[model samples]
Target: MVEMTGIVDVAARAGVSVATVSRALRGLPGVSDATREQIRQIAAELGYVASPSAAALPTGRTGAVAVVSPVATTGWYFNAVCEGAQEVLAANGFDVLRYDLSEVETNRRRVFDTQLLRKRVDALLLTSLPLTPEEVEALHAMNRPVMVVGPIVSGLPSVRIDDVEVGRMATEHLVGLGHREIAFAGGDPDDQLGFPVSPDRRIGYAEVLREVGVEPDPALTVPAKFTVEAGVAAFAELWARDVRPTALFAASDEVAMGAMHEARRHGVRIPEDLSVVGVDDHDMSWLFGLTTVAQDVRAEGRIAAGTLLEALRSGIAGETTVTTVPTELIVRSSTRPAGQSAS
Candidate 1:
């Protein structure tokens, strides 16, 4: 068994003073690079793990970041966020503590309201979870820095793409392809969360449809949870209608995959009989040859983590910086002229 020791052990082994060892280990930049590397090497050779809590007693900094997310098991978006957050946090000598949000209302309330997270983590990275006004107030009241990744909420530092623009871009892409009869597949506007992003995306779809002289048809718009199954089911209902849309603009890649699967099952050719476009550029999009509007989910996560770390270092919380990253359209085989089916 390896003996557990404190900074004194590392300092003694490194043959440096305790204060010099402290600065080198904490990643403070004043020490010479050579000295820092030597101290780090000695510490690693001894398998020494610094206790952020112990350090915090003196410095008031934990050197640990917490991630509060809705679900970690599902969603490529969340996975990307985790990946980016992990990369950045590791690079900066901070540890990451992830808490999978319990979906049960009571559990969620307890998780958010209780001191379960307080005084344990130095900063927080909130990924794609919509915070209510009260919740926002609770986090702000903590007096610790927070960086939200996805959806700009009031009184929080955040990084997000223009979701409305994503929708508009998808619609405009189809419009440019000479598609007028475009359909939108997404979730209910009045979601349990009551956030307006879904509806805003739907609005963008309708706006582009109107700009190009096509009246919005309630029949062509389908609502489903953001999933592949929902996509398939929504498209099924839309296709069953007497007059089907020539093209579809799904709010997410999972939805697009579902729609494509059902279309293929029904022997409907893609881009020939029905063109499709989606958002998020999910990994499987390439395998399915899906044309999609691409957002930097991983980059957003990395930036969010960076922002939180910066806020933590600056000792400022609730600074409320709104960062909007850009998006792009990746042309693929899923879209073509409206009447031209997949070849």
Candidate 2:
């Protein structure tokens, strides 16, 4: 093995600034791939490896980040965001401490305390969970760089898509197809985490209906969890009501798929008896031919992680910049013009 050397010695041999060497070695952004590769080769030859504790000594940081989200392993949106953020954080020589939350009130409330997080991480990333006023106070008291990946919160940076507009787009697609009879399938508004995704989308759906002189009908709205089974149950709600809406705007692809499954069981032909659209072009959406509003969810995760890194580096945790990602309507076999029968 070559003579064991310190980071400074590696920086000296790399012909790059210490920051560049640090970033390159840690796989952080801002360094060219070529530069990173060269730095790695030089460090390897010099027997250099990053020491987590030694690096954090200068900044008094723990070199770790806390990511608090509703179970990161489930929910395509939450899972994808976690993966993206983890990729960035882990690559940057930072340990990711994930705290999975459940709908249980106590479990959700425990996150806001931050009693344990203060001693652990240099920054925090909260994904898709809305904070109560008191909880917001706790974050301020923590006084660390924080990033949110959902609806806007006062005095915090966030990365999210316009969920309200997402609803509008899906509703408009069905409404524009000349189907005045419409239904909405969304998540329960009383979710313990208070995530605004579904409610905002429902607002958009309602706004579009009113704009077209179609009064929003309470009887047509079905609220459930964001899952395939929930969607099936939502379809059952409609079936029981005997409501024959020509079009349905499901809050998510999973829900749309579930509803479609139930619809098929009842001998309803897709785009013939009903036209359906959903949000989030789920990985399996194409297989089911469900049209949907697609958003770059993984990109949202990456951006949120990058924003946190920037915030940590800049030392300005109170930055309230809300980054909005765009969404688009992807038409597929699930929808056709109203009154157009399949030949």
Candidate 3:
């Protein structure tokens, strides 16, 4: 038997008309729910892979999008975002291709310049990866729409929290409880990209310090990678210092947990001896009774997907807009007034 290669084949297998098949495949209006499902199932069973050139020849779309992250498998943030984007994209008849670049320049160039990126995807969803000036320009030049989660690129529609504000918010929460000497626990500010996050968050911490008439002390600032071990190491290093902070504003929940562990080892008490606050409300934050600023990663992901869909349907590309998600302080048993020491 011979195989058919166009809308006719899909329609034949789905028991629908060519027009109905087109509508279902393109996610256009005027198709019944049952018809859409039938068409999709038929397409899948037939092993029918749409050629980008062929698909675009008629509809000018590849029916797919690229989701590029420093790492899509990032603890919670990236995973939630990818889930949200996939939910929306798949529902709209667009498939997702995930790529984890992890900040390797060589891998990045290969992903961008090779067949992996060659017109296979109609758009891109960038999650928390800092694209160099040239990279941003290159995506712009490709003329594909790009939606980002966390921080903004020069000309990309992005969904992000005001990370500086997030940092400040966490700090102010602690300061309101009368924490005078506070320290930051995270990666080195001078490191590459520092992702802009480390520094922006630190600024918020500094702002609160200055607001409370406390001069910024470099000695109080601690640096570590965004990992549990890094957090542990940073806290241990700070513990060795003659002047330990009465409070800590950890960059992430993982860091916060590390600090809590080290504090316990040194016979320091939580909320009693030290007040702690962190960002990301990570999975273990609650388990450890950690206070944190919670941003809905899942909701951010869903909204990003919606924004990208709007752009795709409206034929808009390269419109860089910032969407800020709010953060909430979840007060718990981990913080208290400075004078309370359990050591």
User: For every candidate structure, what is the RMSD over all alpha carbons to the true structure, in angstroms?
Assistant: 3.0, 5.5, 4.2
lDDT of 3 at 51: 58
Identify the superior model by lDDT, candidate 2 or candidate 3. Answer: 2
lDDT for each candidate structure: 0.83, 0.86, 0.80
The sequence of per-residue lDDT tens digits that candidate 3 reaches over residues 205-276 is 899889999997888888975667777888898978766788999888878888889888988888788888
The positional error of residue 56 in candidate 1, measured at the CA in angstroms, is 3.0
Q: Which candidate do you rate higher for TM-score, 2 or 3?
A: 3
Clashes of each: 5, 0, 1
How should the candidates be ordered by lDDT, best one leading?
A: 2, 1, 3
Runs with alpha carbons beyond 4 Å of true place in candidate 2? 1-50, 54-58, 103-110, 192-194
Q: For candidate 1, write residues 36-126 as lDDT tens digits.
A: 9999899888888777678789776778888878755457878788789989999998889887775656646864763656677788888
lDDT of 1: 0.83
Q: Which stretches of candidate 1 lie over 4 Å from their true place?
A: 8-47, 341-343
Report the Cα lDDT for residue 1, model 3: 54
TM-score winner between 1 and 2, please give it: 1
- Give residue 324's lDDT in candidate 1 (0 to 100): 90
TM-score of each: 0.88, 0.83, 0.84
